[model samples]
Target: MERPQQPIEHWLDLERDQLFLWVPVMLGLGVSAWLWLPDPQAWTSIMLALVAVALLALAADRGGRASRAVAIGCAGVAIGLGLIWAKAERVASPALTKPSAVQFEARVERIEMLAPRGIVRLRLVPIRMIDRPGRRSAAALPAQLRVNLPIADLPMGLSRGAVVQMGARLVPPPPPSVPGAYDFARVAWFDGIGATGRGFGPIELIAPGDASGGELRARLSMHVRAQVAGGPGAIAAALATGDQGAIPLDDAEAMRRAGLSHLLSVSGLHITAVVGIVMLVVLRLLSLSPWLALHWRLPLIAAGAGALAAIGYTILTGAEVPTVRSCVAALMVLLAVALGRAAMTLRLVATGAIIVLLCWPEALAGPSFQLSFAAVTAIIALHESPRVKAWFAARDEGWMPWLARQLASLLLTGIVVEAALSPIALYHFHKAGLYGSLANIVAIPLTTFLVMPAEALALLFDLVGLGTPFWWVVEQALRLVLAIAHAIAAAPGAVTALPAMPQGSFALIVLGGLWIALWRSAARLIGVVPLAIGAFWAVSTPPPDLLVTADGRHLALRTIDGEIALLRDRAGDYTRMMLAENGGFDGEPGLLSEHRFARCSRDLCIADRVIAGRQWRIVATRSAYLLPATDLIAACRGADIVVSERRLPLRCQPRWLRLDRPMLAQTGGVAITLATRQVVTVRQPDDRHPWRVPARAAQGSDNLCCSMQGLAKQRQL
Candidate 1:
């Protein structure tokens, strides 16, 4: 007889058993997404193996331990093999040292319907290095090619297997230089993109962008465009088909203000809508059949509807990374319910995350991926918490309870998400949305129900000749919504003050919070600790005074005696914290807008005069900094350097014989740069020193961090 299993062993066994074939398959797909890296062969090989492991696990469900173990082993080996293959392929590809711009015959692989920037992805036909190209090499396969369109023509749609070619400037991918941010090249590579260019150049229609079965999707897009009309037409197009090319920026903001911006993409809502429609159709058809109708067949219909909905949505959305991730998550929900297990939102989210990260490793770094998933995860987690549920549960039956629940959930979600992502958002956009929640409350819903769905309806009218009426109605409604969003966004206190959070601190917050919230057991428990630490850091840490950004990207620091001084070439007068954040940086938690930057710069000029009159000075700009100097003809001198964005200003200036960049940077970091040849130490113990940037910048260093543009240059200032 088999020995009795110990309690611990039983628990372990149960947990291990959760590792089904699909888990590995999903894992592999996620791993495959890393194809965005310079490793397609690896991802492809891994993808194949992951699929194999899934098959093995499923096949061994009724088998003994040995069989399951074997399956797991094979799967693991395949994943490893795939990774190795990717590495080899990367080494095999020639270093893109030669800058060759040419008109080549190529295949259009994919099209990204990004708003404002429509990118057409292409795969270059592999060519041999020799005269008579022998066997085609994977190295020559296009890993990067994109066509940046004006969203208008891009939303027209393309299918899988379309042929196209164009001109572009060939260059190496920008080297990784920023910490805790997404990679740009990998995004291109994953889509088989070799280069990005403007204009169609020429279009010889080899095939319809939609393939054999995508005709219906094409029809839907055309129909919706006709129904919505102008801006709303574009909005509905985005909703119906994941194509938002025509929607004006103002309209998009209105929907955002309505707190319903999520509806624009082909996410849960679109899937749900499609599933509902499909299920209704299928169930009614079954009802007419009479036989299947009596057997509680709705579940089967629901499943079928969900599957169909997923496929339809995928095609409509052009199957971008985010949309694909959402589709996979939705499938998990449907699958869990169908399998008789309670569909846990968090588990679905985790599963989806695993799928996304593994399949497209680059997405792990993208802000859209992070923010969308964050908001979703927070909402679901809050909804599922026993305490929160109970709190809402105890309420009496009335509108007050409903309203209270909505407000509470919103507040919790806003605080948690903003708290979680504020650092990263600032690090990337250089602006945080301080009053985003207030704007979202009024915006998200209005966009969701009023704008999105109504716009989607207009598409149907477009199918027929009479599309004007529906289109007109949507435009009128959209204008009102747009007006409201702008009015509210412009309202006083809609945004608040925030500047760039330090890079190191920002990274810690995102990594720590994500870990705590996602991981289970002891790991998950420790996650909240980071969040607490981050909150304290935020509230107590005062704003920087001497801030500098060069190459118009990287920003660097200084904090002053209760007032902030900014040094940037961007906008200023809009520097009110509220304007930057509420403008979309989540109410401007960190970093101000160019408009604000401009305003502040003007004021600084005045402040510099007052400061100079008192014999107090600070280095404020790359234009040799603000110093009091009287050479009697040759040199200008003041007491000392006040603030310095120039890493070493005086040395380059020949005025001061000896120069210490660190002394100035530290002093400037604290907005105390007031002396030259005088090395002043910053007293803040937590301040990290020398703050080296990744890519070199010849334009001078920024306070917060250097931008990719800043570093991609050949020279450093």
Candidate 2:
């Protein structure tokens, strides 16, 4: 007698299979929300509430559709709350508010040479902080500090695991440069770096550290550098040791523009190559022995070897989040093989994501995690779609059918990955690599077939002291890869700029992507609604009318004709580049040289215009400079807004709005629309969050009269 599988049982099985895929997504969303909470204590209340709901769901009756839904909802909440707790534990630390000169001994964990900038960045573990002269205690300080050392001052033979004592002025990492911009402080917090600063003087080597694993990795990087030379050598070192700082900035930028930057990083592709090569070699060798081949499960044995090799590769590459993610994915495949189950399923991807988030929830906010997972998810979804499979099967078979199939697969995979990642790339970097798919068509095969294999063989040969020839081969492949990147990047309009999407719209886009990728039925088409809405919103967003830097050191105003006019010439390149890229400016009429409407001298610049039939005058000055009272009074009388680096002591009409250092420090930056008289300020919500380091206490009150008189007298110039 045979029993038939009931429809309800089949449906339940399908639901169970799909349910695991959404767990990580929900957890990531909750973690993002948790990061935005104004107070850390608020997570406690949230956790309690979520736990109650989860318990209620858990207590629901089983074997019903509603029960299954409740169970899935409960699982998602539990995962989210668990991640919130994990993140809180990782970021918890004492605040470092004030800046002070402190002497400390530290072990160099990592060192990066910024050749273009002539600086060396060191990641250090603090041994001791001297609170006062001639007195030191091992009292708790920040776990780590990222210090910059000028090339001229860098000590000789500086290497990882070497202990050094040095004096430096340390300050808490600052908040974001602009609203909705990357939060360096939050990132530093999770990375265990409490402060950042420049070393003041010479660094003295206190003692040599035992050659640890990190030291060995550094030695390997140095050896790779020695084997190769110049920029290619640096690229080889990056491939060998995951120290990307070796690559030149310009080349890195080119690679990014060409969408080939992933080649430099040890990610999924590299992991898979390593594992696949090892597994194939090991399996072939095992099969050669008849006794073992007959007794053992060859596939399982090969998978085990692959998993081990993947783990080794991950460790050798510093076990970064991406490496960990790739390793997890590889291991999941191995596990499925060992269990005689489907190996390449979305469930495996979801399982990998859950593991990564559980171990390092902070990665949820990073672009690498998002983009990598998105690419994988989309590829799996598209490749497994019945319609896509049927369509491909229906295509005609021509000459060289196998080669045609392989090439078609590669091209389709590239297209799917690019489509999946474009929104995220535009949202994060504000640039779209238009030729990314074409570049990948050439790059993916070249790297997978030639570059990575050569590097792996070289490393293995180096262990036996016979790697020179292989290293030479690696250098040649690297040169070709770099050439490809440069050629692609040199293409006209290789990268296009897009305006930043609103947070709400970005959320919608993310939801749409998930819906399309995760859903199994025709209902997935509903995702197009949100995707279209997000795209429309992004295209419709207008550029800001006025731009100001956080330090109040530069200002730009939009002319009536929609051209940007710089208020000052010496603004920082970082702020200028970010603004220019986000505003979709192109070549011709450069950001710096175009629209010279504002006139400037050593101390002052002024511009005037009529907006919406209202006359608006703008005045800007440095704090150290002086202006004659007659000029100042007259300017204030006519100006609708006055902005200065420091507060000025001129009585202005009530209609005049003053923006100075104190105000700018709080707002970070501002954009004003002259038509509606609406002011939009860049103030990050996290600036006021409880986890942020408190600002230093205010100094004494200002003497406006004395400052004004001094300015008047200095006007004699």
Candidate 3:
């Protein structure tokens, strides 16, 4: 006589152990809330009140089971918010404002050699910075500076902790190039890099510090490059030292396009390989002694050895966030083995993510954190599927069948991971690698089994001058990896570019994916609803119809042909590239001056286009010279929008919007959509944060005629 399980009880039983998997998701939501809030302080009281409610719910003994789960989720979110706020406050430092030529004495903290650029980048902490020519009081220096110098100009004795004096021109970390675009300034702020500069005059080494691990890493990179040469060498050096700066831009681009860029970063795959190798070698050595194997815990000893190796390698390779995360995951695996527990599970991934989020909440805003976690989570979910488990457990009749099964599993994993990460790629990079999964099927195995091991062996042999043989193997393996990358990247339909989507859509997609991955039973399939809706929303959102650069020197407008046309054909490469990416256009931008619908002149330009069933007229200034007062007024009077780098005369006003110098200075850059009459600025009016510089006071407007008269009087004086 056995009791039958109720339907609800069975469902609950299925998900009982899976509940913890949602903790990281809750924490990430909180982090996202903090980051996305325009004014964190304004929402502070509300968030804390919610936390209080959650706590009371938890403390109460008479509530529904659902209430307890909700309480746990709220607590996780509150902790995440508190963590990020504390980290931001703790790392707060002065940031440089404006540009200036400065001379300073500083201690070098780190160095990166950019071989293709022929420059050396140094992270420095300044002792004192005096303005150039000694004509003004010393300017307030940032907590840290990143400066680039010509390779030839680098002092021979320069090394980490070395004190040096140099003259350089520095500028504050730049803001976003467009509204809702990537914010490098915020990234720099979190990293404690307040400014960036280029060396000008001579750099004199005042004190050469003692030998350090950073010096060792640099020497190793140089030695590897010298031994291997070219792009392959750069990749090998990156594998060895985690210094990816030396990789040629072309090679890096190819790798990114081919979806093998993860190989360049030391993460789970690399760490797992390193740990497995160390454990196997150590275990084999211990087993060689029969008495020791019988008397001692050889597995435990090997696990300890592997843990040490993982930590040592993590530190040696600069300890990037992904690498550190992998190291933690690997250590946890080793700990599980030592304790005789099952290792790989959703819990392990969730635990690692929670630990990382706790320590570096700022990492939540970065692609590395999102992409890595998404990939891992997807892979784990795929393998843990009941159907997949059953298939894997089925008897293998022969070696060929087993091999086929393995290949199929790898392909399936790759596809799942690519699917999980595509939304993120589109949101951050505005593009997704369509062929990444296919490329990774070959690339991951090749990199994990052959390339990394060969590189490690080559490095070991280099110590005694016997590394040439292994180095050849390393070079050939890396060459094959590059060949795969370039071939895949050159293929048609290798990438899919999408218009940037709103944060809400992206969040919905992520939540849907998490729901599917973190749960079991029939309800998990319900996630498809939100997932499909989010995908549709992201794809259907229209791009901005107008974009203006921060300096107001470049403008792009959507034409009747649906092509993005730039005002200047000679715009800088970076700006042009970003605009194209944002617009989801692959071709070079056609010049608006050359477009059929626009009329251009020496001092002014006028363009007209129909958007959302309405014709909009746009006017822009082309020259610094003041236009005729009547001409300026006439051009703007009927226009829907006016864009000018110079402040317009009081008589010149647009019906809808006017973007002039003062406004551009405050907003940073702007993107507008004609259909909804919506406007977005790189720096929103309420984006007063720790790193943002305050906008200057505006000057009073004057009529063109009055300005001309004043200019004439000054000339007469």
lDDT string, candidate 1, 1-717, tens digits? 654434434443554533442343333334334432233454556568666776877685653454455566556545544543454345332223323444444555544444443444343442222222453322242444454544444423356566554444454333221221223444444344443445444444444554654455556666766655566667666767776655666666655544445556677656656655556556677678667767775777767786777877786677777777777777787788788887766667767766665565545556667776777766676666676787767555788879988788767666765655556555554445555665556545555555554554555555666656656766776566566566766666543334444444554566566556543334356766776676567545444333322121223332222233234444443343322331222332232222222223421321232232343333233343444333211221332223333343332232221122443322221212222211222222222211112111222444323322222121122
Candidate topping TM-score: 3
Could you tell me which residue pairs clash in candidate 2? none
Model 3, 273-341: lDDT tens digits are 888888988899899999999999999999999999999989989887779988998999898888888
How do the residues 408-488 of candidate 2 rate in per-residue lDDT, one tens digit apiece? 877888888998888888777777788898888887777777776777788789899998898888788778878888998
Which has the greatest lDDT? 3
Model 1 spans with C-alpha error above 4 angstroms: 1-107, 110-143, 147-166, 175-183, 189-223, 252-261, 280-291, 394-424, 438-484, 496-500, 511-528, 538-717
lDDT of each: 0.48, 0.73, 0.82
What's model 2's TM-score? 0.86
Q: lDDT of model 2 at residue 103?
A: 81
For candidate 3, the lDDT comes to 0.82
Q: Extract clashing residue pairs from model 3.
A: none
Q: Give candidate 1's root-mean-square deviation (CA, Å).
A: 10.8
After superposition, the stretches of candidate 3 with alpha carbons farther than 4 Å from their true spots are 1-13, 131-134, 559-563, 600-605, 622-631, 693-717
